[model samples]
Target: MKFADYYEIMQTIARYGHALDAGTAPFDQIFTDNVELDLTHAGPPGQPGPVIKGRQHVLEAMTGSADDPHTYRSVLTRPALSHHTTNSEIVADRGDEVEVRSKFLRLGNSQPGPMPILIGQYLDTLIRTIDGWRISRREVISHGP
Candidate 1:
């Protein structure tokens, strides 16, 4: 694969973190319309969350609950002071599609001091679309302390 293609894929990963942190980018722009999101591993033990299908549902989940004011306020304010890092490796490059395995880390000042809130690995499948590289599937596997 061309270096530019790899760079674009990296940018897409960065955009995912940026969108989550800022809540500024629309889900459709970063992910495919029929994206499959597996965040089950992020849930409690023996209680993996359901595999979310479609972009709208995924967007809603990531944006937090609108019915609860606390959840809404927390999502909007918490990540603003955080830093995100995505250490990604291109595991497969098929010209039109690419698979990346990434280590994701988030550090924020939500507690006494800046500390890690999450450490995880993302298995991402990206497709080269007319708009650019967009994530088609994402499986989040979180690391426990």
Candidate 2:
């Protein structure tokens, strides 16, 4: 991959957290039309999480709607909540497609101090589009709640 491609890919990954935190995630910029978000391992321990499909559904899940209550809007709207990413590695690059593995940390500050709410790794498959690199699939593996 070219240097510019690598940088753009990293920026796209970082944008996910920033947009979500801002509550103005541009789903089209971050994900493909048929995106698959596998949160099967992102829920509380011993519970089966959801595997959201399609960009529109993903938007509803993240932003919430009157008809859809299973959303991350609650946690995202928390004043003290923030998302951080580190250790991004491009595991594969085939010009038009790439795979990235990265670590994510969710933190919350309240009362006395800030604390980690969740730690996990993101396995993402991104495809090049006319707009730029967009994630086609994202499988989140949680290490802790």
TM-score of structure candidate 1:
0.84
Per-residue accuracy of model 1 over 1-145 as CA lDDT, tens digit each: 8889888889888887666666464565678878999989976678797798877767667666434211233353364355365668999989899999998877767447777767888999999999889999999887852
Each model's lDDT comes to: 0.75, 0.85
Worst 10 residues of 1 by lDDT: 65-74
Model 2 C-alpha lDDT per residue in residues 39-128, reported as the tens digit of each score: 999877888689999988878777765243222464365887889989999998888999999999998886788789999999999999
* Model 1 root mean square deviation, Cα atoms: 3.9
- Candidate 2 regions with alpha-carbon error over 4 angstroms: 66-75
| lDDT value, residue 3 of candidate 1 | 89
Q: Count the backbone clashes (under 3 Å) in each candidate.
A: 0, 0
